[model samples]
Target: MIKRQAREEDETHTAVQGCLRDLGKSLGYDVWIAANDRNRPLDGGKLGDGCLGELPAAVGQAPGADAVRLIDVLWLAKETGRIVAAFEVEHTTSIYSGIVRMLDLALGPEAHALEGMFLVAPDGREGEVKAQLARPAFSRIADLKVHYLPYGELKANREAIARFGEGMKPIQAIARNLV
Candidate 1:
């Protein structure tokens, strides 16, 4: 049962990442899936979502580039090439690792005014995510205004938003404020 549950969670994680990638692309931002996840099947294509071969010059040259590259998904501004948003689908894994990865990009040499830094996870885990962010070690995350994107919310509205949503506004509306 435990193993089956784990597999289920992993599938959800991949799905959420795929949803985010599609949403970002439709909203006119370039999407990127984590390097390790690129080959995973998603949305009729691999999880890489046909992303750029490398991180944009803006983030690629910044410190912690390696860590930032591993963030579950990113939405880059079309013109500036800056990362407008970063997401880590926590699913059933350690939220701590996701937060750490977000922090790496947030605190990197380049000052990124991310439109949203989200932890996409199961709705039941909201409290766990809040507890982790409340820790002193992750204090900056609060300042960064990291948010929680419940899988239910994303899965439910992803299609409508993709067709009619403008920019990140619609996506932000679905996310819960954790700061």
Candidate 2:
């Protein structure tokens, strides 16, 4: 039962990641799924085959290239080649790691390129996300502002947002300001 529950949560994580990828692509951004996650099944193909072959040159050259490449999903402006947003999916794991990754990206030299940072998780996790962000260890994340995007909202609007939404504004409207 424990193992089954874990698998279910992991599947949810992948589904959320796939939703993010679709939204990014729909918004005309160059989506980047984490290198490690590129092979996961999505829409009848591997996510790796759906996203960029490599991290954008700009991000790959950044200070935290290694960490940056591992972000769950990144939406980069097609022309500017800079990250428009970064998302870390925290389905059943501790939220600390995802927040930490966002912090690293927000504070890195390419920080200037990031317009948004998000933590995607179950809707019930919003309160938990708030509590975690309130920690002193993540004080810097507060200043940078990390948004909490509940899976419920993302799943509900993924298709509409992909078909009708324009830019980050649409996504931002659904995600609550966490910090």
Q: Summarize candidate 2's per-residue lDDT along 92-139 as a digit string, tens digits.
A: 789887776777788877789787899998989899889988888877
| Model 1 Cα lDDT, one tens digit per residue, 1-179 | 99999877777778888888888988888888898888887667777846766888878978888889899999988787888899999877888878888888888765455778889988899998889888888888777888899988998999899999988888899999996
Give model 1's TM-score versus the native structure. 0.92
Best by lDDT: 2
Question: Largest TM-score belongs to which candidate?
Answer: 2
- Model 1 gets an lDDT of 0.85
Where does candidate 2 stray beyond 4 Å?
none
User: For model 2, how big is the CA root-mean-square deviation?
Assistant: 1.2
TM-score of each: 0.92, 0.95
